[model samples]
Target: MARIELLQVADAVAREKGIERELVLEAMEQAITHAGKRKYGQEHDIRTDIDRETGEIKLMRYLEVAEEIENEATQIPISEAQERNPAAQVGDYLADPLPPIDFGRIAAQTAKQVIVQKVREAERARQYEEYKDRVQEIANGLVKRTEYGGLTVDLGRAEAVIRREDLLPRESFRNGDRVRAYIYDVRREPRGPQIFMSRTHPNFMSKLFAQEVPEIYDSIIEIDAVARDPGSRAKIAVHSNDSSIDPVGACVGMRGSRVQAVVGELQGEKIDIIQWSPDPAAFIVNALAPAEVTKVVLDEESKRIEVVVPDEQLSLAIGRRGQNVRLASNLTGWDIDILTEAEESERRQEEFHSRSEMFMEALDVDDVIAHLLVTEGFSTVDEVAYAPIDELAAIEGFEEELASELATRAAAHVEATNRALNERRLELGVSDEVAAIEGLDPAILVALGENEIKTLDDLGDLAGDELIEILGDLAPSIEEANAVIMMARAHWFGDEEPVDGAEADEAAEAAAEEHERANV
Candidate 1:
């Protein structure tokens, strides 16, 4: 290429890819020089340069000026070289320029490839500098085009990619549309810099709230935690440092206009702005919004809650298809189960009858008189009965002997609860369907309501295709879900049942009933 044309190419490419012209020139010189060595031969000591004015490349042999020349490849006699062209004097070196670059055929082919690769590398480094520190920051872009699987977003100075996974579900961008995304990552690679953008990350919601809510930006209102279902719904837990300002109301904006703008930006993604609470129970209840929890029954060992609601409100609390409950459990990190009016009543009556029967059994045994054992807060009968004395003694107000008696009575209760629970399980039948959940999180169960993935055993049967079909884009994440399921299943079956809340209730009631019957 001519020198002027070379310079023009450099200018155009540098501008197009946001690279420096000097860097491009340096890259070109090094690349051409390397090609010169391989084409002619690395055996020759060669130097190459692109004339600044001509944009033409020049190659030459660089030999040292010496008293006597013995090696033709590297040394030249100063005196002998002077006779050829008196431009050189003794002790001075002369440039022995080579033939104009033919770059003919193979040589030309090689040079082109080198320049392309070098420029791509330079562009990648420049992009990395622009985006590496931008994590959690928002940027606006013009939708240049939508490729097969993602959108090309053009920032004023650079471009980024929003892939299918990064997109909020059911949301899309059209060519030339204006869009905003949270920069998720900027990676420098051999090919180029990859600027990753996301619209579905939880932090996106947090940052968006900060943008729309002044209190959040100014630190008057603080976002404690956020859990999201992306395009479908999101739950953000916020708190106000200044007691006078209502955090939830501030986020909702006056007449819901502020949050509405953010919602519209996300293509109508729903949001639930909630006040945060330090109390887990309160937080759990608040998290399950749109569904009023009449009462929250917590089992300490289980770290679970049984949420009781009006029978009519079950579907609402669980959300249209249970999204509400799912978000709540994720937000609180607690397993929750929803109970209705009839279910709660049956549980209570069963509890009373079970205790009465256990006490009646104790009365029949003479040695066990007026037993003063404490109900170690167990909810089910069998857990205490089959449980070890040490496990029972671990409960508050329990002694070794008391644990022994309680464990024995608990054995009976557990045996009974097991028989009944299993009979119900049998009636449900073991058909082709599998409900493979390891243990039940009442809250998560309530949230999952109808969307439940039955069991791990069942999950293993699902082929990747089937799993993908069930979750759509979420199908790829089935592995992670399976991991949690396996862990929970192991915990449910392990010796470490840890006496859940329901178990504790049974243990405590057994103690009270046994004491009453002995005295009578």
Candidate 2:
């Protein structure tokens, strides 16, 4: 209320809010200046200065010298300046201090409102400094409340928002529940600091592992890479500094107690701990664990791997709904394709039989059936899989219902063809062997999706572990695989021509010449 008391109020508020006293004084000056401008029309430049030392207030009015003083608010005449300072030149600009006008009632109210607004602005700036750098750091929050699919969390110092997409899939927090989140982003807005958080970040998993594993926390074990499908599964690749220290074992903990602790925080999502390997092939195999990979062909250019697992383990390698493979892809930074043993055979068979496979044995028209199916028509085995019953009925001399029956019977045969085609694709290098296999049927091949297999060259590149994954479902005979390789070796690399009499004599002469040179 009084001049002396303004200093005491400024000092006390500054100390309480941790703002500089000069800043408070500057704010007081600006606020009073604003209120004065509103009350006394600020058409001219107005300055209000507060002496922090004495708590005295002074207001000055400034006007530009103009030939004609059009508005009284902004211009002072040459005669007015000479009256105040007798030596003043006609062109000299002058400022006049307005005498202290008491803020009897209304001005006091305006000053109080101004002071309140300035204090709020200073407080906001102070809070922003306290929270801005916390971006990307982890923080714990209690679920304060929820509205419109978003969460408000109290992080002790400030509140943070956790968006629905930022949440772990299938995991929900109730009001008052404590949750940890990765600080994904933070922004200083006009209202306040907006701290964004996420429980779905892959780094959150890495941080959790570091917290749970003493070795990792201590730097004795380092997590090399991590892949995650938040709220479902994750794969982490870890390494140890000492050969004796088992990095994977340490991360897993005794009976998986350590990982379980982390998992509990994450609402039961599964984590697979794997030993990081320098060899990409070995790492890929390890990544697709629980499904034995038979071979892995690396495409370093694409950062992709064509992996082959046994004919039975396909589903397991790819995982339930492809989550396992998906996480592995993220962790490894690799594009992975899984192929089975039968698929390899079916691929090669289609390639080799592209022409000859259409011609039938002993029947000319039935042969036409194969020709039309492959040459002029359906490219996919699925097309033949669901080919119209009437088409088969139209085959020369084919009858009613007999045609449908033929379609029904051909259904099985079509599946066999597709399966055989798939089997051919997988034949190390020979699709022909898949075609020649006596029991092969195109319809059966189609059903088994065998025709989709393209080439053995394609199969040869796959990681064996990928094919081994197929064992979970289509368990093809391993012995048959070995036999196919043997046949392939015999057919392609084996004797292409009989040894002639002249060649035998030339071989004997060469051996004699070699023996004479050795003896010499």
Candidate 3:
């Protein structure tokens, strides 16, 4: 290629592809190097360089002068190199300039192919670097085409794709339509950079709100959380650091203009902006707005909340198809179960009766005594067994002697239950190794043995969800199940610290084996 022609081509390709001109020049040089290798011998070390300022092409064959010629193709003896140039020394590379070749049809096509491949690689790299950091930011683009229920969007300099599932429900984009979406992901693939866009992501709505509401962008009001039902309804939880600012009001703007802007972008999706509170109960109350919550019962251990609403507001709290409560649960990061006042009352009564019955059966106490125990917040035999004798004696009509007797009976009952469970576990032939896993209590062991998880290997092979399903309500949460499984598999990792009763079992086995060997 001519010097000026090469420079003009490089500049044109750089401008068109939106890449650095140096990259195009490097690609051209690589193409020249490939063509040179084909014209000369493929075994020779051919290198090519293009001048940045003048675009002058230089092709040369390089040979290294070594004490011993390792490869005749690319290495020469130091003495032979000194004959070519007296100043040449060992470990020096000698370059022989070659005239630029005139391209035939095949050579020109080959050079163009190499240039195209390298330029494409550079373009993909450029696109990846440009958009990788832009994930989660809102992007504006024109719909370029629709393929397989997905839309390809042209974002001026780059192209992105919004899969059908990522688009709003019942929404479609035509070619040339202006669209706004969140850059959910940018991935480097063999073909090119994959820019994944989403219109229905909760963050897209949050971003739109941030753009419309200056308080949110300026950090005066913070968007704590967002949950969406795509085109139907959504909820946003916001909090204000400034005591004077009303976070919900600021997001809603004058006459609901700000939220309306976000809703417009979401294709008429309804938005509820609620003020966030540090107190979970208060936050839940705010989340279930327009529906009056009569009471809330929170189980922090289980991360669940039972929300009781008035009978009239039950339907409103649940919304159409339980959308309201679902979004509220997502917003608060808690499992929410909505109940009516009557339902809550019935549940409470049933729980009271059940606790009374449990105490009556376990402690052999009368109905009145059981009711008293239940009223004093003693629900389990373990609680009664572990309670201080003085605390039980303080109960109305309870003497210290009677409290002590009850405590003794409670302890005996719990021991009996555990003994029965252990007997059953042994009868089922659960290996001591399985039972010795750190988190596997007697009940869990019985459950595991019943399900044929009778060894440590079996327990280790179980996934968290599998373990939870096997143990039913007695199983720990998924996180705890995973930890238990890891403990079970610890012996496989070579560190092999004995867990629980594993060391005792091993010693007993060794002693029994020694006895058998002596008898033999």
Residue ranges of candidate 1 with Cα displaced over 4 Å: 1-13, 49-58, 62-112, 299-302, 362-520
Error of 2 at 150 (Å): 1.9
Considering every candidate listed, which one attains the maximal TM-score? 3
Which portions of model 3 miss their true places by more than 4 Å? 66-77, 361-365, 397-520
Candidate 1 lDDT, tens digit per residue, 1-520?
A: 6678889988888899899998888778877787778867786678888877778788887766777777777777877776776677555656678886666678777877888888877877877887888877999999999997689999977789999988977776789999888997887766667788999888888888899998899999999988888788889999999999999999998899989988987778889988799998899888988778888889754478899999998998888777888889888888889998778989876765565555446433332321322233443344456667787677665678866876666566556655665554444442222334533322223222234444443443333345445654323343444443334334333464423333433433343354456558
Predicted candidate 2 versus true structure: per-residue lDDT over 178-294, tens digit per residue:
989888787889887788888888888888888889899899999999888888888899999989999989998999899999899888888899989999888888998878988
Name the weakest run of 10 consecutive residues (lDDT summed) in model 1: 365-374
Best by lDDT: 3
Q: Rank the candidates by TM-score, best first.
A: 3, 1, 2
Tens-digit lDDT track of model 3 for 273-324 = 9989999989998898878898899988678999999899999999999999
Residue 276 lDDT (model 3): 95
On the 0 to 100 scale, the lDDT of residue 467 in model 2 is 32
Candidate 2 similarity to native, TM-score: 0.59
lDDT of each: 0.71, 0.70, 0.88
Scored against the true structure, residue 109 in model 1 reaches a CA lDDT of 75
